[model samples]
Target: MNEVFAIADEVAVFRDGAYIGLQRADSMDGDSLISMMVGRELTQLFPERDKPVGKLLMSVRDLALDGVFEGVSFDLH
Candidate 1:
């Protein structure tokens, strides 16, 4: 018998009534995770290309989750 492992990277941005999601193959490494986060910009957080890292790292205070399928990921069989 054998066991397989997979790691996923995700970034979700919540809005007034909806949200955006992005995913990439991020492994168990700091540099890889940072690179993947930098690459995927399909949300408001990374909406602008010239947004500085400092701005990007700002505290997203009091963030809450409210959705029909909150915090769920989709996969194909």
Candidate 2:
């Protein structure tokens, strides 16, 4: 995780209660770490979308969540 890389000097991966391996946090990336944990090389964690992005379908203005958040606005396309 980002936190591990930020604070730790080395990272150790474990799977199914067994130790996998250890590598320096500075020398490892998220994909590689995940691949080690999963026991496989991850080629495409997120597949590419087939279709191009479309126009805006919805819009939100001045959205609020009680005492949590307020004045939130966004658009979905």
Candidate 3:
């Protein structure tokens, strides 16, 4: 119930709607498909981050999680 699911082409990403950290498994499912979105993938595509902006790139990922919890829960068929 706490988990929220989102579709991204052939990938789906589950969000915590609380924490911003992409804890190991949280970033990918069992199919070896990535659980991160295009933007998240772009931000984390590489790890040569030794600059200021690069360090803060993942900072706003909270909105992705926050967007889930901030709204009213709904029912769909």
Local accuracy by lDDT, each model: 0.41, 0.91, 0.40
Highest lDDT against the true fold, candidate: 2
Q: Per-residue CA lDDT of candidate 2, range 1-77, in tens? A: 88878999999999999999999999999889999988887876666889987999999999999999999999899
Report the lDDT tens digits of candidate 1 across residue range 1-77: 01111433444434444643444434234443444445543354446667534423333434447763354443322
Rank by lDDT, highest first: 2, 1, 3
Better structure of 1 and 2 per lDDT: 2
Candidate 3 per-residue lDDT over residues 1-77, each given as its tens digit: 11322432233345555333343444555333332433355436676857554333222322334645543443322
For candidate 1, the per-residue lDDT at 72 reads: 46
Error of 2 at 39 (Å): 1.0
Pairs that clash in candidate 2: none
User: Could you tell me how far off, in angstroms, the CA of residue 5 lies in candidate 3 after the best superposition?
Assistant: 17
Q: Estimate each model's TM-score.
A: 0.19, 0.55, 0.18
For candidate 1, give the lDDT of residue 58: 39
Model 3 RMSD in angstroms: 15.2
Candidate 1 segments whose C-alpha is farther than 4 A from its true place: 1-26, 40-77
